[model samples]
Target: MQNTVSSTEAKPKKKSLKARMQKFGSFLSGMVMPNIGAFIAWGLITAIFIPGGWAPNAGLATMVKPMVTFLLPLMIGYTGGEIIAGHRGGVVGAIATMGVIVGTSTPMFIGAMIMGPLGGWLIKKWDDAVQPHIRQGFEMLVNNFAAGILGMILAILGFFIMGPIVAAASAIMGAGVNYIISVHLLPLANIFIEPAKILFLNNAINQGILTPLGLEAASHAGKSILFLLEPDPGPGLGVLLAFSIFGKGTAKASAPSAAIIHFFGGIHEIYFPYVLMKPALFLAVIAGGVTGTTVFSVMNVGLKATPSPGSIFTLLAMSPKSVSNFIGLILGVTLAAAASFIVSAIILRRDKTPDTDAASLEDATAQMSAMKSGDSSEASSENIENARDVVANYDNVKKIIFACDAGMGSSAMGASLLRDKVKKAGIDMSVTNTAINNLKDEPGLLVVTQDELADRAAQKAPNAMRIAVDNFLSSPKYDSIVLNLKARDQMDSSAAEPKPAPAAKSTPSGALDNIDFAKISEIDFLRDDDKVGTATMATSLMKDRVKKNSKAATVKSLGINDIEDDENRLVIVTPEAAKNLKTRYTNIQVFSTKDLLNSPDYDKMVSELK
Candidate 1:
């Protein structure tokens, strides 16, 4: 049965003024909240790992340390893009976003600090340069490639200059923080703040105050409102309050999820829906947040780094040396949660409800079921059946190539992950990591890399099917590679029970029928004295044959610099195959694997001959 609401439902009412304000606040909170996880992680690491005698870790030194450095900057870039351009804009938007992250954290705010503006500038430049140039046919693809290049270049430049500036700024900020806490705030803060921290606010102040100052010892401390509060007091109290005030319905139902999420996941985004629905409740949250921050500040209950939000795990991970700080964090979180719940409940109790609560529940359930069904169908069709089924046969696959910049870091990691995954899938494909420059013109080559680098791979191997990974190391998104492999395997399997071979066909260039000159060993132009020049000339000579015949072909030449004979054409070899060819022929023209696969001229020539 078709649901009437799906077809002609009226738009939900415009959010009230208070609702809008709450949303704005939520957005603000979102910016700060998500970073809490990072902060907690850093703080915990510092508290546990860093030596006491060493200089207090600040943003400069800490940010560059391995996973946090790369991940945090990238996250900033991605998140910034999302905020500005929604999801699609995120691609270029992230470049600008990283700028903000760095700028906000850096000391003198010079050098790589300019990355934020540079990223923004590059996005604008790309938009201007390509948006109008985009036209029909292959031009669209080209323009997209140009934009990606522009974004990447801008990101690299921005990071290069900004990284140091930000680092310096971070150092300064850290020094300043140490000064403030040790000289000014610690003495008084430790007394009152420690007590209040038991409720959760002590941690809040520590983070909020230290983060901007660049003294964020605990990474999570400065990232979110809840991070300042202790987990137990904050989320646990919130749960009880949600139940007592909102009652045992959907609002109540969501409360537990919110509690779990805020307590464990450290995601404040989950609580956004609740605040959006009840605008007045926003003030309560702020009051709770401020109260929590103040208490945390006075108690001097510090965390190690940021985690998600106010999750107990994060606080525990980042807590300072003193056990009292942990106690403060718990007390602070509980108090804040309790306070928020009380205020929210009091405000909600007076509201009247319709008598059809049961009906509402039934309708909600039905809607949820329908949504689930639709989602399932879409996932099956788009994510699984069509895209994934293309390459099912994995056994026959001989080689897997991973392409990326410098052929290091992310690509290496991705290849390793894929190898493990393929092994589990019972596929015996050999995986190798290489730069785009090293790709050969071989048959059955698979190029895998991040979407940003796909264009370069395509240029190197135009005929090879490219699989774009969403992230460097995410396993779920690796399905595209797996599916493509599976598809290829299936094709191989199908072809294994081959029918009778077709009659040989000759090419317009008089090349042997169906024979790839590139694969043939008979061609030997390498004997020519001017081998480099002859090989260079051979590429053009073979262009016509390549255009006419879609078979493996090559022009070679002898190494002698003086020879000017046509035989010299046989010695041409691509850079990659040069070593292999050097041992056999004095001079040889070797068509690259890519050249054989992508030579449209060969396809044309072969088609004409047929």
Candidate 2:
């Protein structure tokens, strides 16, 4: 009892800390990420047109300093202020931001970020305190004057006070970084960075901290190694490759694809789960990070700016266009990957508990149906492993928002899948996505987020019903979401599966005559209960594609025996599954694919269904 009590108490405290950390990280990133386009524009200008740049056009180079020194910081300030208050705040934010730019000799990226939101927040506070008492018709004059006066005062204050303070802080940060390099201890920063990244602090570390420092350093040095530290995809690639080779069950199968996404697509969050599933893998990533950073430092390789997706292509684009720099960067990433792969493989192979692959990150923290009857998920924690058993009163949830750290990538894909599911189930709820920090505590809001971000989701929208999913692509929880939505609106007329568009209006291609397009309203993928995750994902992807193209066919994964023996449904299966399907049922139409998820024939196949 004592041990259980201690453990229970510890969880909330741990959750609170993580939530606070995420909140802090998200706050900083929120200021930077919205203004990334400005950063990229300046980066392109500097990269292609500066004296040391690829093109080295003196005419275009003239534009570089002005953009970086003035336009970029002002835009950042305006964006930060807009995030805090609104357009008025943005105006003041930029106003206040100008003071800092003039006050500091160095590029004042830090000062702009600080002043923007500070100006916005102060203006918002003034409005809140004074707006109710303002007379009706003269509102515009009074409001304008108030903003102007406050902004004027704030601008002066920023120039005399905040600008110098932030300049000092930026100097200290730059000195700290230089000191680390001087001691040849720069690589050790990964000891802290790697863990924070695994906790979904990648955005905070990258946008909030590294990018600002890196940009400032780049202004003087022409490039900065700080850009390479957080966005290095090498460690993640190494870990994923290890999992693909040495891991078991779903993890092994998923790692190869996850690796492609992480390395090329620059969605680094994909690898975090593999690390989370096996905590020992932290050593592998840390080792990789240290090796990569050491190689970069020794080679003196750096980029002009931070890469958005952090992909190899972006890294090269941002690289200084020198052969030696390219070699150094490639070698650093290669050796880093090699180091991580070796460490991760050894960890996987030597584990006495062979459960690393068997237990998914979701399985460790899933809390599905056990929280029914008004009990918090924590109350039913021990019993809530299976997502299918998850239940909730989604009747109160009129809108569904899939929340993630960055708000795009995984969350967008998840929203696409769930939106289709909700539409198919004839549910009327709106499904969308935004950054976790952007979530609001509005009534009828249901927030879905990855398990790692559950605490942050709660912190952002405490009143919202939060569901932690396995992943964005293929969580078993999605089916439960659909089913629960249906159950909640059982009495609604739209609760029935939607009727497919009529086939009579368009002639079928008769490519596969047996399919009988008029009779077929649905398509089925072969599903095995033990390997449900794969089938679910394939079905979702296929469904989304088919819905976009054909409009008349619904797609789902069903057991071989569960499929109806009728021409009204077309069954898609692997060649092996098709052979068994023929043995089991003669009436069902079958389309066999070497790859269900991706086939050259899929486009032609959808055309025939018309």
Each model's TM-score, in the order given? 0.38, 0.76
Q: Global lDDT of each model?
A: 0.46, 0.77
User: After superposing candidate 1, which stretches have Cα over 4 Å from the reference?
Assistant: 1-44, 52-117, 123-240, 244-249, 350-356, 359-610
lDDT of 2 by residue, 366-476 (tens): 222222212234322212333222233454678999988878767887899999988876678899999887888788887888877876666567666777865677565
Q: How well does candidate 1 score on lDDT at residue 214?
A: 35
lDDT of 1 by residue, 191-244 (tens): 343333322222233333323333334343432222343233363346335754
**What 10-residue stretch in candidate 1 is worst by lDDT?**
1-10
Model 1 CA lDDT for position 10: 20
Superposed by TM-score, candidate 1 places the C-alpha of residue 179 at a distance from the truth, in angstroms, of 11
